[model samples]
Structures are given as C-alpha cells and as structure tokens.
Target: MLISHFLHGPVSAYPRDYVDGAHQELHQHREAQLLYAVCGTMRVVTAQGAWVIPPTRAVWIPPLVEHEIFMSGEVRMRSLFIAAELSPPSLQQCCVLAVTPLLRELILRAVQGPQHAENPLIQSLMLEEIAGLENLPLHIPMPEDRRLQGICLALLRTPDHPNTLEDWAQQVGASSRTLARLFQQQLKMNFNAWRQQLRLMEALPRLLAGESVQSVARDLGYGSARAFSAMFRRLLGENPREYLNALNKLSELNPLL
Candidate 1:
C-alpha cells in the first residue's frame, strides 16, 4: 500500500523511532524522500537495488518509487519529504548519500515541524546540500534477467561462498563469458564489482552489531582481516576498525548524530 502524507510545503521532515527487526512492507510516497537513520542502521530495498544505510549515511529515493524498509536495530529514523516538482535531475534515481554534519543538523532542525514562513531558508539549504552531496557506493543493483537474478539471490544467501563467475556459469548452464557479459550489460558492473558491493552490504550491519573485524572478514570469505581492511578502506576511505570506532565515538559524544 502507498504510505503517504500531505506535505505543507516544498520540504518537510518526519521523525520516528523503530524497534529492532521492524519491517515496512512495500510502499510508495507521493513525494521524493531522504531516509536517514540517526542512530542505527536500515536496509532499504527498491525496484532497482538494495542499500544498507548506517548512521553516517542516508538514501535518496525518487517520488513514487516502490520500496520497503527493514530496521537493523533500535532505530531513530529521521526522514525528509520533498515535493516531487523540486527533485533535481541528479536525484531522480535512487542512490545513497553521505550525511555530513551540516546536513545532519539541518535534518534535526527541520524535524521540529517548523512553520511555513520560517522554512524557506532551511528548505533551500537542505535541498542544496542534498543536490551537492555525492552518491555513496552502497547500492547493489538488481539485474532483470532471470538467470542473473538467480545468481544474485544465491550470492546474497551465501555471500561467504567462494564461487567465482566461472563456477556460477558451470552451475547456471551459461558460459563464463556469457555470464560476464550479462553482468556488465544488465547490472552496469562486472561480476567482481557487484560481489564487492554485496560484501560491503553484508559487512555494514555485522560490524555495527559489534562483530570482530577478523570474524566478519573470515565469515565473508576474506583471506584475512588485513585484506578485508584494505578493501574496506579502498571503498569507504576507512578501515573497518577505524570506521566502527569513529561511529561509536560519535554516538557517545552526541545523541542527535
């Protein structure tokens, strides 16, 4: 069902808390949305892909894009709804955005349900921040082809599996080259790139839940913690330990963040 509410202006904020394991069934909104998790993590699934949003990140979804949300833990969700007409070309597609300090404060202020006259400046700043923010590499695009879909689903179920594209090709009745071409043509990425995204998606919640880096690395099929840390740093600009430490430190220092 569609879960929408009337917005009083071009931008408005909705803040709500969720319990652990909460699930929002498939729904759509009349306006575009920025879903932010202030303290915990969330998994957002859209028709195009899935994104794991930690406290430091948020997802931008275009108006009327069917999606569902799964809360990873006790979550404080702060969301902003923008009038569909105000959505920019850059944000027309569903993607994840890195929430900076300025943006975080803006969201908190907006969530106070500010009056219309006083909202013009805040709305402009929020929109500008969102438009200028770069998309994070937190998305896992889903391929439309049934064969590729099967492979993607299986990998999600057993992300630690060491099956290569060639191995999957043997099992799926397609040549390795064909599988490679399908991934590129349909997912806009190679097999390895897609798998890397999948691994990152799997790692975020585990790390947030206090799993050891070494254990997470081993469970996710990495040869060692060092190798996993290298990959994490290359993609997210921080090693797993550093990333988790920063998040924990921030959480201790500020509740709004």
Candidate 2:
C-alpha cells in the first residue's frame, strides 16, 4: 500500500522511506506537483523514461501520467500540488526544473502557511512560481548495454579516479574504439557527453549536501572549480554557487529545514 499526506487543498509535504522493492507508483493527480528533495535522491520513472533526481534539483509532475519514484537515500520531500486550472500549460508535462531563489522561497512559504481552502493568495503565488520554472539541459540517460552499464557503475563508484575510455576498455576487455561505438549507439551519446552527464549527476547530490563548488569539482575529477563552473553554466545555464545559494534561501524560508 502507498502512504500519502492529504492537505485541505491540492498540496502536501512529508518525509518518506520506501523499503519494498516495488516502485512507488502514483497515477498523476489533477494538479501539477513540484517535488523537492530535502534529503537523499529519487529515481523518477515515466513513459518518457527514467531520470535520477538528486538533491540540488526538483522534479515536476504534470497531471494524469503514471509515474514511479524510487528512493536511493532517506527522502524528505516538500511536495507542492497545484490545482489544474491554476497551473501553467507548460508545467502540464513531466520534467525536471531548476529551482530558482524566488520560486523555492515561494514553495517554502506556502508549505509553512495554513493549508486552508480559503488561502487564495498563497495558491496564486504557488501558481505564479510554477510558471517560472526553468527547464534544464542537464539530464542522465539510462545505459543499455551490460558492459557499458558495468563501466558506468565502476566510474560512479570511483568518480575521482582519473581514467580514460581506453583504461575502462582494458578493464572491461574491450577496445576503446568498440566502447566508444557502443556508447554512441546504445546511449545515443558520445563518451565525453556521457561522462559530463554522469559528473553533473554526481555533482548535484554533493552540492545539495552543502559541499563547496571547489570541493565538488575536485571530487569529480575537474582540475579547477572555474572549469567546473564553466561546464555547469554551459549545461544547466547557471553557476554551481548560484544554484546552491538559491537552495539555501529556500531552506531558510521553510520551517521544516
């Protein structure tokens, strides 16, 4: 059985832990939900495919689609469920949005306020903030090949390990040329692209845990924080520090934090 917190309106906030191997399935509500990861990570699987939601980002669930969320760590989720009529059409689709300072604060404030049906002002502010969600290009792709999956798991286990495709290929008993070809064919991306996605995924959890940008960069095998920041801006259109600061402000506004 699935557990849920019911609010007076279309919103809810609570902590959750899933121990059963069964995925947490929810047939989409009539409202859009902004799911923020207060702690730990959530793996969201939908018809569009699966995406890992680390702490630094939130996943937006639009109305009426079946989705399953799996937890990797203890999860504290602050879920903002908005009425269908009040939400933006764009948010009607499931996607991961980069939470901004203002939007995050708005959510925090809304969560702290009374969950009365009469609170139209809070509801309006929630809708406005939902409209402001910025789509991010940074996303993790599911690996198809068993060998490639093995390689990725190895890399994730040792992110700081400086190893090229050739090194990984040697360990996997495949040539670098073959591994590169398989990555492009199965993952629909090249080696560097896959590596960048993995790095970004790893960076999110660290950043959310309050690690400094320099520390995260170094941990992810980047030579300097500046280089890491440049890649972050190029991919997600924001600096690492700016993203963390926005989350910090959100935490400040939320009494639960």
Candidate 3:
C-alpha cells in the first residue's frame, strides 16, 4: 500500500524495533526515507536491487520507491522521513549510506524529541549530514529478464548452490552465451561476480550474529576460509575479521549505533 506521511516539518524521525525473522511487507511512502539499523541487520529490497543495512549503515530510499525490510535478528531501526523537496537530486535512487557518528547522533536526537515538530537546528544538521554521506557498494542489482530473474531467485534461496552459468542456462532453458550476455547487460557484471556479491551479502548477517569466519565460509560452500577471506578482502577491501573489528570498535565507542 502507498502510505503518505503528514510531516510537521521537512524531516521527521521514527524509532521502531523488530524481532528475529520479522518482515515488513512491501510498502512505499511519499517522503524519502533514511532507514537506519542502529543494531542488528536489515535487508532492504527494492525493485532495482537489495541492500543490507548493518549497524552504522543506513539505506537512503527515494520517495515513492516500493520496498520491504527483512530483519535478521533483533533490530532497532531509526528512520528519518524527509520531505521530497529536501531530498538531494543526486540521491534519486536507493543506495546504502555510511552513517558517521555525527549523523547517527543527529538521528537519535531527532527521534528522542517530538517527532511531529522536529527541531529546526537538528533537521538542518541531519539533512546536511545526509547530503555528504558516502555511498557504499552494498547493493546487488536484480535482473528484469524473466529467464535471469528465475535463475537469480533460485540462487538467492540457496546462495551456496555451486551452479555454473552453463548449469543455470540449462536449468533456465537458455544458452550459456545468452545468459552471460543478459547478466552483463542487466547487472553490469559477469555471473560469477554477481553470485559472489550475493554470497557476501548473505554472509553479513550470520557473521554479525557471532558466527565464526570458518563456519560462515563452510556454510557458504567456500572450500576454505582462506578462499572466503580473499574474496571478502577483494570486494569489501577488508577481511571478515577486520570488517567485524571495525564495527565492534564503533559499538564500543557508542552503543547507540
């Protein structure tokens, strides 16, 4: 359903909690949204792609974009609904944003006070912070072609499925060459790259839940932790342990985010 928020100002903040396995059905609002997971993890799915929001990260959703949120564990979500006019032109599409400490604090402050009548100073600071946020490479683009969509959906259900493009092509009734072409044209990546991204995205929540690196790697069908670590470092610029360490450091500094 399309929901319209009657905001008293340009920005309004909201806080909510969700338990493990909770799902927010597909919905959209008139205002652009900054969906932040202060704790736990959230997977935000939209028409174009899916983005994983862990602690210290948020998804910037442009107005009128249909989406759904899936919680991996207990989630404390802090949301900011900003009027469409206040949304930055450059951020017309949904993407994950790196939430800095200041931005996180601004969000908390906004939500702690009266939600309807937002403080002008905090609203100004929050918008400024949002405009300068760095976009993270946490999105996995979904394909539109029916053949590719079928294959992608099946793989998402089982990320560890060790199916080559040739294998998927046979299963989907398309030639391997044609499937490769569609992957490049639609997702801007080869099949292997896309699958790797999907695996990593799926791995994040489990890792945050205290699953060991070796366990996650084995569960994801990696031959060894070394192979998984190499892939993680190559794509995310850090090993799994290092990535978790950074997030832990942030938590130690401030438990709020």
Candidate 4:
C-alpha cells in the first residue's frame, strides 16, 4: 500500500532499525525519499531494479515508485523524505548514490530533530547536498520477461549459484541463444556481466560481517580468492581490502554515518 506523508515542510528525516532478514513490504510514499543508513546494508527492490546499498551508500527514490526494503543485517536507517514539489527535476528516478561525510552529518542532525520541520539553513543545505550526490553503479536491473525474471529471482535468492547461461537456460526451458537475446533486449547486458554485478553487490554485506575474502569467495562460488579479487578489482576499480580500508577511514572520521 502507498503511504501518504503530507509533509508540513520541504524535508523530513526518519530513523528506523531493522534486524537482519527483516522485510519492508512493497510500498510507496508521496514524498521523494533519500534512504540512508548509519550502519548495515539495505537491499531495496522496486519495479525497475534492485539496489544493494552498503553503509556508505543511499537510495534516492522518486515519489510513488513502489518499492520494498530487505535488511541484509542489523540496520539503522536514516532516511529523508523530501516533498515532491521541493525535489529537484534531476532526482525523478530511483537510484543508489554515494553518501558523503558532510551529507551524512546533515542527515543525522535532521534525524536528531523533527521528522519533517527543520531549521531553514539545515533544510536548504540538505536539499542542495542531495542534488549534488554522484550515483553509484550498485543497481541490478530486473528484466520484465517472465522467463528472465525467474532466472534473475533465483540468482538473487542464491547469488552463489554456480551455473552458466547454458545451464540456467536449460533449467528455465529456454535455449542459450534465447536467454542471451532476452538479457540483451531487457537488461542490456550479458549473463556473466550481470552475474558479476550481482556478486559484487552481495559482497559488501558479507565483507562487513567480518568474513574473510577466501570464505566469501568460496561461498559466492568463485574458484579462488585470487580469482574473486581480480573480478572485484575489475568491476569496482579497487581491491576489496582497499575499499574496506577507505570505508573504515571514513567511519573513523565520522561514526555518525
């Protein structure tokens, strides 16, 4: 069902906690949402795609886009709901974004106060900061085709499924060529590429849970830690350890985010 948040002001901040595996049913609100978290991971699914948001990220959801949230682990979310009229034209779609240190503090301050009403300076600064956030490539597009949807859902449920496109095609009662064509037509990517994106998206939560690279790689069906590291570097442009180090550095500077 859709939740109508009749905002008395331009921006609203909400903070909530979800234990691991908790689910927020498919729902929407009238306000554009900037869904952030101070800790844990958020898996946000909508009609268009799925977003695997780590602690350092957030999702910008346009008004009335039906969506659901699945907490990967114990999560504390600090979400901002902006009145649709106050939202900029650029943030009219749902996408994951990299949350900066300053923006995180502003969000926290807003959360520490009222849910919607806020000091004018804080509201203006928050809106300006939101409009400037750079989008991250953390979204995994879901296909519209029923056949492809089945395969995608299965993969999402088990990201470590060690199967090729040929194998999945056979399991889904379609030929390899047909599967490839549908992926291209709908997701605009090949099977391996899409699977890689999914794996990387799922990687962060496990890594944050203190799992070693070797353990995560084995569970994710990678041949070895080296192979997984290589793929991770290629896709994210940084090694897993390095990425975690940077995140740690940020946390040290601002524990609020």
Candidate 5:
C-alpha cells in the first residue's frame, strides 16, 4: 500500500531512529521524504538506483516510491514528509542532496526539538533552503541482468575484492568481453569505472567515522595513501582530508552531525 497521508494529511513531520546495521522493509510514502543522517551512514536503495548518503548529505525520496534503507554503524535518522502537491516538480524524483547548515538545523528541529517548519518564518526558510541545495551525484545505478548482477553484488559485498573483469568472467561463466559489454549496457559505465565509484562510496562512510587516510587506503586495497588520494582527487576533485574536514565543519553547527 502507498503511504499517502504524510503529505496529504496534517501530519507533516516523520521522525525515525535506527541502530547500527538497521534495515527497513520496502515501503513508500505518500509525501516526499527528506532522509537525514545525524550520526552514521545510510544506504537508500530503490528499484531505480542505490544511493550512499554520508553525514554531510541527505536523500530526497519522492512520494510513492518503493525504497528501503540500510544503516551503517549507529544512525540517528530524521525525516520530513511534504505534501505531494507542494513538492517541486524538480523534486518529484529521488535525489541526493548536499545538506547546508541551515537545512540541517531545520531538519533537526523538525524531527527533534520542535516543529519549527510549522512556523511561518521557519517554513519559508526551510523550503528556500532545500531548494538551494545542490544535487549530489552519489548514486550507483545497477543492472538487472543476472550475469551483471552477480558481478555487481560481489563488488558491493566487498568493494576491495580485487577482481578484474577477466577474473569475474571466469567465475560467472561468461567471456571477458561479454562481461565488459554487459557492464556498459547495464551500468552505463565500464567495469573499472564502476568499481572505482563503488570503492569511493564505500570509503566515504569509513572516512567519516574517523578512519585515517592510510587505513582507509589499506582497507580499500590501494597501494598507499598517495594512490588513494590521487584517485579521490581525480574523481571527486578533492583529497580525502578535504571531504572528511567538511564533515567536521558541519558537526560544529549541530553536535549530532
């Protein structure tokens, strides 16, 4: 059944809390959901795609979209459900958002302190703040083909599995070229590119949890910190420290962050 009341009903606030490694069954809301992670990592997966939401960001799930959430480590989650009619046309689809400090505070209050978004002053600011948030490109698109699914699932389980496409092809009983073609057709990216993105997404939560660059590198199967930094810098245009420091900066405003 579709959950339609949160948006159409008078109850606009939805607050939820989850422990480490918590998993929620598939469900859809009538109203769009702003899923914020106050302390840990959240992985939101839908039929359309999969998103890795770190501390400094959140994901917007449009109304009536079946989805499930998996938490990494301990997680403090807060969400707001807006009326479907009130949701922006651009926000009708799910997206990952880079949460601003102001938006973060509004979400916190909406779920924790009081319903500040109910107040006229705060409501306007909250909507404006959300509109201004830049869309983050943090989603991993999955392929539906069983052959590709095996490869993707394996990498998803252990991102540092160190399996080349040739290696994966042998295990899956497909030619290396067929696997490569499947990667392109399903994921819209080659195997190596997809793996790089997977490693990056996996590394974010670990780094945000206070792991050192060297350790994260070792865990991700990089030869050294420099190698990891080069890849991160190349892909994200910033080193690991820059990304981790941004999270630290966000925590200054809201301690839960």
Candidate 6:
C-alpha cells in the first residue's frame, strides 16, 4: 500500500539561511518545489542537467525528481511546494527559469500571506507566476569520458591549480591532441571551452560565498580579477558583481539553501 500525504493549497514559504563558504545536500520530495534565491549563490545538479542558479533566476524541480544542491556563501532563500496537478507540463521537466521582477514580487507576497488562513488570491498569484517563468539555456553538460572525467574531478578537487591541457594529458597518459579530441567528442566542447566552463562553475560558489573577485581569480588560476571578469563576461554575458547579485536574489527565495 502506498500511503500518500495530501498537501492542500499552497505550502508556506520559509527562509533558508547559511554562512559564508558552506555547502549542503538535499533529497528530492514526492512533490515539486519552486526555489527562489533572494541572496547569495547556489549550484544544483540533477540527472538531466546542472545549473548555477544565480540570484536573477529560479529553478523548478518536478515531483519525484532526485537532485542535489550546493551553497557557496551565506544565503537567504525561500521556497514553495505545489501539488503536481497544479504544475504546468513544461515545469514538470527540471530546468532553470529566469525570474522577472513581477514573478519575484509575486512570490514574496504569496509567502508573506497569513500563515493560518489560506489565501485564494495568493494561490492564484502563485499559479500566474509559475506560468510566467521563462526557460533558460544555461546548463553545464556532464562529461562521459573516463579520462576526461578524471581530469575534471582533479580540477574540481583543486580549482586553483594552474595546469594546461598538456599537463592534464600527461596525467591521463594521453597526448594533448588526444585529450582535446576527447573533450570535443565526449563533452561536445573543445579542451579550452571545457576547462573554462569548469572554472566558471567552480567560481560561482566562491563568488557567492562573498569571496573577493581577486581572491576567486587567484583561486581559479587567473593572474588578475580583471582577466577573470573578462572571461566570465564572455561566457555568461555578465560581470561578476552582477552575477553575484542575481545569485543572491535567488538564494532569498530558495527553500533549500
């Protein structure tokens, strides 16, 4: 017998608080969850994709979707869980959505409603807000090559280490050309592109944790924050401060920090 818990109406919104430079894990629930980050930065990984959910956006996790979330710095987040039937089919797929000002305010107001009494207006607003979510294409593809995976795991373990593809190739017992080819074949990106993506991914958590851009740059093997910022802008189309601000906003609404 499968016992089910019925969550009638909208679930209450609560804040998720965290300290600087910390990380945690969360398991999937039977119901879908809407996360809004009000402050700080967060990275979420699922079987389908991995997202660096900055403050200007939110992530929708459909019911029964197993996922893991990591926090980079002190985070202020809020979350709401809605019944699966109330969720749109598009949202049933896990993906990151850009949070507009209207949606942000709507979520804040819905969460601010009275705790005891069910607010029909809030429910309606919540549904409207969900309908307005714009799907985004920002995602990191997980590599499948064992050699590439080993290299990536090593870099993740020590993001500050300055190692060129030649060095990585030697460690993996392959030529630089072979590693480059493997990157394109397995990750659909060239060696430099894959490495830059990894560095950018690593930088999100550090920047959100309130680390200075200079500090983060040094940790990521860049000589200067300006250089790092340039690459970040080239890839993400935003400066570090703007990116962090967006991430902080998402953390404010994130239920799981």
Most lDDT-accurate candidate: 3
Q: Higher lDDT: candidate 1 or 4? A: 1
lDDT of 6 by residue, 28-115 (tens): 7666777776666677787654777766567887877777777755556667677777787667677678887776766676556454
Output the number of the TM-score-best candidate: 1
Give candidate 5's whole-model lDDT.
0.79
Model 4, 1-257: lDDT tens digits are 98865444788887788899999999999889999967789999988888888876799999899999999877889888888898877778788888877888888888886642477888998888888988877879999999899999999899999888999888999999999999999988999988988998888888988899999999999999999999988976788998888766655555643
Instruction: For candidate 4, report its TM-score.
Output: 0.89
lDDT of 3: 0.88
RMSD of 1: 1.6
Residue pairs with backbone overlap in model 5:
3-30, 4-30
C-alpha local distance difference test of each model: 0.87, 0.69, 0.88, 0.85, 0.79, 0.71
Clash list (residue pairs), candidate 2: none
lDDT value for model 4: 0.85
Positional deviation of 171 in candidate 4, in angstroms? 3.7
All-Cα superposition RMSD per candidate: 1.6, 5.3, 1.9, 2.3, 2.8, 4.7
TM-score against truth, every candidate = 0.95, 0.64, 0.93, 0.89, 0.85, 0.72
Q: lDDT tens string, model 1, 160-233?
A: 88998999998889999999999999999999989989999999998999889999999999999999899899
Candidate 2 has a TM-score of 0.64
Which digits, one per residue and each the tens of the lDDT, describe model 3 over residues 68-146? 9999888889899999999988898898898988988888777775742377888898899899999877889999999
Indicate the residue-level lDDT of 97 in model 3. 91
Q: Write model 2 residue lDDT over 131-167, tens digit each, in one string.
A: 7878765555657677888887777687666888999
Query: After aligning candidate 3 to the native by TM-score, how far in Å is the CA of 136 from where it should be?
Result: 1.7
Backbone clashes in model 3, listed as residue pairs: none
Q: What's the number of clashes in each of the models?
A: 0, 0, 0, 0, 2, 28
